[model samples]
Target chain A: MHELSIVFHIIKTIEQVGEENKLEHVNSVTLEVGEVSAVIDEYLGDCWKWAADRSELLKGARLVIEKLPAVTMCETCERTYATVQYGRICPYCGSERTYLLSGREINIKEIEVG
Target chain B: MQNNSIDVICAAAGSGRMEHFMKEVKILEIKKSVFEDNDREADALRGELHEKGIFLLNLMSSPGSGKTTTLLRTIEALKDRLKIAVMEADIDSDVDAHAIAGAGVKAIQLHTGGMCHLDAGMTRQGLEGLEAAEADLVVLENVGNLVCPAEFDTGAVKNAMILSVPEGHDKPLKYPLMFEVCDVVLINKIDVLPYFDFDLEKCREYVRMRNPEAEIIPICAKTGEGIDAWADWILREVAAWKADK
Candidate 1:
């Protein structure tokens, strides 16, 4: 449901970049989505195909996605661990004084123009 | 450049052949988070709200979690002491907004059209619609969804969530991110403790395991069991917010 809104945001950003670079056509876009971002790539792709086809610059544009691992930092032991594996608790020290360091991102990494 | 070298080699070994082999292609590096714009807007809104001395509390919970009932009860408790307003966000109707207005406080409904969550920009617009500048407290009753609402910040001074006893005590394990970001977690519907097998202590432990700093308050809005404690928490938060200003 929210994927369409996200696609619109992505298209607006690419259009701004295109305008700044004086480009006419966008061939593809590369996105770096975190493992824990809760944004499903399949839905994003479907939404992109529906929305991007309507834009003049993004017609037939390809969408590529890259995944980033989620990591958590333990303040007690000052160690980093996989968030998906152990959640909020630190595996090394059994400490709940931990916070997420990464893996909640939805980034546009690159844009290819032809 | 590599293509140009390949073209040069092709020309050297060619048997009298000419072709158009050069094409202009640009690979622009745009390493930007899709949420960067929203996060920046949230920070700016936070700064603006802080300057205006308005304590914004973002309330989130799952559907049928008695968020409206809790809000009404809260208003009855704190309306005499503080000026409160509500911005109710929903995907479709204004039912919650109407309920809030019936409570005799300023209320505004934000129709997200179809969006599942409320972003900072949407919250700012809602605040403007409610004329929240004059109110001492603005409660943004965010759209009822545990997963999506926790993903976005709406420039609120504090984030609070409600979990009813019927919703099960294992909510923290299922929705860890929500518990992780909340400053306070209100375990509501404790009056039904005898009916359901909801373990209050186990629930508290689950919430604490995810967020050690979060304050868990047990309440039954239907009977006003823990309304005083909840109201006190709000007053303390409002005072601390003012002190920071």
Candidate 2:
């Protein structure tokens, strides 16, 4: 699954950060995932638990996720609306000239170490 | 050593877990994109390709969308003018690679070991395996999937996808990211358009709604119709990529 690859990327990034900061152990990691980023949180958590336990520094580390809502901007109306509520078509203007403003983000916000 | 000595003293003084209580936990603010590493790797690979004067095209599409057939046609059209190579990525099997090699070009197969997509690192490895420096154009036939491949950049100079007539025109709306990332959309199997009730204009409109800048080329890889236009697009892209530097 793509979530496994994402977990691998997270581990790799965390390992790089650990080396740079000389971290002995990671306590937790917080992620900022957009609402429509296509990443399933449960699958990500499952993949993280399986993969993190294999890394000595990240063993037993907790995974925290913070969701960012999806927003779309209508070019015709110049108004922003919830992407999930009203998809490609603008609800206000009934126009197809709309683009996503946000909601596809998958970022690592922070990490806790002890 | 100081903390260890304090812990020993605390233990000797019968202070229950004073050292553990005194240990400080710190939060490191690393506001980084999850794809930051991959994106950096992809950019570096692009720079390397540019210096080598090589054009890498990342081709993506669904299974049975005629990627291999279209690639064969493309090679037949451009093989005489340009040195072309291919890296076929799949979860298993070397069938695509074999087909490409049979076409009298350098071809290598990359097995992703069940991964659905190829990242920048995997692409570099494939390029190395193919000894791609000898070739002017190296096409990475990415795993035949629309979703995961769009999320990962394969370090290619350009990205293209094949949407067959049977797949419906709403694919751009369904897989918006795939269409948005592609530089060109090849609408293949146009020979059967009359039988399929596939409206080319409607498809173009949908793709434009997703990506206004994408160039759509309608072709039938089987009949070799409109292949010259596709070949022309490649020729122009390769020339532009080489000339820019």
lDDT of 1 by residue, B1-245 (tens): 12453231111112112223336655666777776667778899989988988999999999999899999999999999999999999999999999999999999999999888898989999998888778889999999899888878888989999999999999997888899989999999999999998999999988987888999999999999998999999999988887898
Candidate 1 on A11-111: residue-level lDDT in tens?
88778766755669988988998888878899999999999999999999999999999999999999999999998779999997777799988888877
On residues B1-245, what C-alpha lDDT tens digit does candidate 2 reach at each position?
12464342211112212233335866666777889889999999999999999999999999999999999999999999999999999999999999999999999999999999999999999999999897889999999998999999889999999999999988998999999999999999999998897889999999998899999999999999989999999999999999999
Q: Which stretches of candidate 2 lie over 4 Å from their true place?
A: B1-23
lDDT of 2 by residue, A1-114 (tens): 489999999899888877755679989999999999978999999999999999999999999999999999999989999999888899988999888899999988877778
Question: Can you tell me the CAPRI class of model 2?
Answer: acceptable
User: Taking the candidates in order, what DockQ does each have?
Assistant: 0.41, 0.46
Best by DockQ: 2
**DockQ for candidate 2, C-alpha atoms:** 0.46
Residue pairs with backbone atoms closer than 3 Å in model 1 (clashes): none
TM-score of each: 0.86, 0.93
